[model samples]
Structures are given as C-alpha cells and as structure tokens.
Target: MKRDKDALTLTRRIGVFGGTFDPIHIGHLVAAQNAMHAAALDQVLFVVANQPWQKEGTREVTDPKLRLLVVSQVLRTIPGLEPSDIEIQRGGLSYSIDTLNELRASHPNDELFLVVGADAASQMPTWERAEELSTLARLVIVNRYGYPTISSILDFDQPILAEMPWLDISSTDLRERVRDHRPLQFLLPETAIEAIELYQLYRNRENG
Candidate 1:
C-alpha cells in the first residue's frame, strides 16, 4: 500500500515554469515547491520572459536581463529548480509555443510539462500559436485562491489541475511594500532581497 501510494504521487519528469519573475518571492517559491512535490516532477525550469507581450506598450516592466539574474540567485538556494534564459536570449514577445518547441528539441526523450496558473490557462485560446501549444507540453495548472477551477474554455483542451498550498504573496504587493519602505525580511529569499537592494529595485514606484 505504501509503495503504491508513493508511485501514484510521482508526476512529470520536467516542468517548464515561465513568468515575468519581476520580483521572485516566497509565494512563487512555495507554488513551485508544491507543484514539484505533489506531481513528483524531477525538475522545474523557471523561464523568465524577455518581452512579455502583455506587458509591453501597456505597462512598465522591469528589465528582462536583471530579472533573469535575480531569478537565478533565488533558485540557487532551492534544489530541483533551475532558471532558463531562452526567452531573454530570443529578444521578442515571449510566446509559450516557441519556448515549448525549443524545450522539446533540447530534451526529446523527457516528458515535458508546462506549469500555469488558472488565469493563464483560461487565456490559452488567445495566446500566440495557441493551437500548437498543447501538442508540445502537458499543462499543469497550479491551484490559486479566488479563481474557480477551470478545465477548458473555447474548445481548448483541459489542463490537469494540481493541488497546491495557499500562499498570500504577490509581486505587486512586494513592490508596494518596498516603495513604502516596509520590511521584507520573511516575505522573500535573502538572495532576492540582496539583489533588490544591490540594484535598488522598486525604490521608485514610478519606474518599477
């Protein structure tokens, strides 16, 4: 019974977790660790977006190169997690399909999984090359509060819902705290905190 239960817990071999990671925080770390343990994934690559289409021309986004550096520092303390700069190197609107295609070519033998939140999964139908995304990776939607569980919308294939821990942390809030000069001793990793201080990130809300 124990062996069977353990076997059932194992999930994917490799998971692709792409995001802005503007300020990688404890909440994001918790989500990734939760996904890895619950799904039994061997490893997860945190891919920081270079030119997030949604952010460009509408919102102020942090420098992609700096974001990548911060993500690497944070992931160093956490095992089974690695940072990928594929999109940063590509230098354009980061598309899910393009990243997945690259991963498939690099690791043809490994079973690939794409990590997503309920919101991103819901917007799949409208994503760039949306039709081809499902073919490249198996989607694993992370559990986030307030958002109802969504399967498939607009004829898109349903993503597998993953059970995760609740963490009330957001980059928006973190930035606000920084702008207000609030303490962030426990909300983020020391490396992330150090990087933010070293580069003076989020000091001025107008620029962050």
Candidate 2:
C-alpha cells in the first residue's frame, strides 16, 4: 500500500492537524501529541482554518487572527508542535485537500500525514474532493473513548489508528466558561487564557 511505503530517506515527516480551533484547548494539544508520537512524525502543524465550512452558519467563530494568536502563544512553549496559517493566508473556506496541496508543494520531500479524529475520519467520504484528498496524504485517525465508532469500511491510504485518552473538554464549554467569568485555570493553558483575556475574546458573545 502507498501509505505503508518505507520512508527511509524522507527529509521530514510532518503531520497536518487542521481545525477551526476557534480556541485551541488542552485536548487538541493532547491529540496532536499522541498522533505525533504514535506515527513518528517529526512535526505536527496546527493548521488554523480561516473559515470552517462545516462550522459556517452554525455559530459565531472567534476571529482567525485571535485564534491563530492563541495557538501561537500556546504552541511556543511546546516542542514539536508548530502553528501554521496556511489556510488562513489562503483565505475563504478552508478545505483539507487545498491545505495538503499547498503543503505538498512547500515540502516536496516530506511525508505528510493528515491527522484527524476518528469521528471526522468516518466522514472522509463526504469531504470536498474526497477521492483526491485520500491520495494527497496518509491518514492518522485519532481514536478516543470509542463512542463514535468508525466504520471498518473507510477507504483511505495507510490509515493509522492512534489511541488518545479521552478528555472531557470542549471548545464550546470553554467559551461558555470564559463568558460566564468562570475559572479556566486548569482547562486552558495560561498563555492561551492570557491571550484570550488580552484580546477580550468571548467576553460578550454567546456560544453558537
């Protein structure tokens, strides 16, 4: 299988972990770490979506600049994690295939793995240009708690299943916590919390 091909001479093994990341939380960090370690990725890029298509028309999303700022602030303290604004720079709806294509052109010799949650992987067939997306990079399906069971029928290249400890946290809840002036002490990184406060984000908006 193409996904299983030995990368004996690859310059880098980069994992693309794309998300709306309206607010990047601890769980998001944990999942990225687990995937990188399990898949032996050299670096994991936290690709912030400019406008998440699925999330569009759903609720108000934090500004991309603020979201990217928080991500950069938090990731700066961590090694092996990188903040990318490729999708944000592209502007408009952020699609996985488009991101991968840009990455492919930029890192021609690197092995690219598209890191996604198991729940998201199950819906791979419905993504924009699904068939072509499958060929752009190998898949790393991060499994957590096994609640939303992924069907055994997803046809993607060299799908690697990476298990992650389930964290009972969500961006929605985090946003609410901020809005209510509740303690976010242990929920988000201090840097992220500081950045949020510095920008006065989510202080006046209701969760969508």
Candidate 3:
C-alpha cells in the first residue's frame, strides 16, 4: 500500500529550556538562541519553574506567574522562542523528568532537546529519574567561552554543545540589583525590565 505524502507527520525538533527565570536576563536568551541554532531546533520553549525543589529552602523565589510574565514579554518579539507555564500550571516542585514526561505525552512524534548549562550538566546524576532523561530527550549543554566541556560520564548520549561568550549575570544578582534600585541597562531586555517595574517585583526581599 502506498502512503500519501500528506499523511506523513514531520517530526519537529523542540528545545526545552527550563529555568526559574526570576527575571529573564540576556544570558538566558543568548544561551537559548545559540542552543537552538547548534541543535537545529525548530523552536525553544522557556519552561518557567513553579517551585524549584533544589532552591526551595535556600531563598525566596519570585512568584511563578510574575516570572512567566517576564518570560512571555521578553520572548514576544523573538522568533522561535516561546514561554511555557507547564510547571506553573502543574503546581508543584518542578522536575525536569516530570516536564519531559508531560511534553512527551503531548508531543509524541516530536524530537525533544533539553537545554542545560555546563554546571547543571555535571549534576544530572542527582536529578529525579535522572537515568530516564536519555529516553525522554536529547541533552544540549551550553558552555561559556573558555569553559571546557564537562567530561562527566552519564547514561545519556553525548550532549550537543552550544558555545557562547561568558556573560556575568545571574538571577540572584539581578534580584539584588533591582532591590537596590541599580541601573539594569543592557543586562536584560527592556520588555522584561518594564514588566518587572510594572509589577513592582523584587522591590524588597520581603515582597519578592
């Protein structure tokens, strides 16, 4: 029997770039864009964490809705980058395996690429259902300039490496800068900065 060409489902390559995104910064955006290009991803979804289990007791996390809002606003004008509230909607400790499971269920035919930083890649073994990540999606590790690709062994296939110049930016630093009312010029997208200002987010640790 001959199958119709129109009946064939084209497999799309989707990159899942999950993060706390307390306030999406330029580093995060650059990593995702470079990862997408390096991995040949069709699109990248910025999955905002509802509650990052690892950071639960360490410090305060910005509200998930507010974080998602920042992500959406900044990604609005960027092509092939999207904001996903999957973890936020699920309402629990955000786990990569859980998110990948949900994405797999919804997108069975598509190829999934999980993007992570070099630092995070070294700790994959400690993640929940860590061994199952290989079965769920291919890993794409983003390494900053001058940083060597990690040699840690894992069960998954060799990760695709995306290299970019190092940017000295962190969510913690951004939050503190906002708290101190310091200028954030060139650190984050204007849209994200605007959203942060509009929501009066991170004005203080107590309310952040």
- Evaluate model 3: give its TM-score: 0.94
Question: Which regions in candidate 2 have their CA more than 4 angstroms from the true location?
Answer: 1-10, 146-153
| Per-residue lDDT over 16-108 for candidate 1, one digit per residue giving the tens place of the 0 to 100 score | 899998799887787777767755788989999998887778658889999999999999867899999999988889998899999898876
* Candidate that beats the other on lDDT, 1 or 3, i.e. the better one: 3
**lDDT for every model?**
0.81, 0.86, 0.90
Per residue, candidate 3 scores C-alpha lDDT tens digits across 25-83 of: 99999999999989999999999999999887888888899899889999999999999
Worst 10 residues of 2 by lDDT: 1-10
Shift in Å, residue 80, candidate 1: 0.7
Rank ordering of all candidates by TM-score, starting from the highest = 3, 2, 1
**Clashing residue pairs in candidate 3 (N, C-alpha, C atoms within 3 angstroms):** none
Q: Which stretches of candidate 1 lie over 4 Å from their true place?
A: 1-12, 153-158, 205-208
Clashing pairs in 2: none
In terms of TM-score, the best-performing candidate is 3
Comparison by lDDT, 1 against 2, better one: 2
Lowest summed lDDT across 10 adjacent residues in model 1 is found at: 1-10
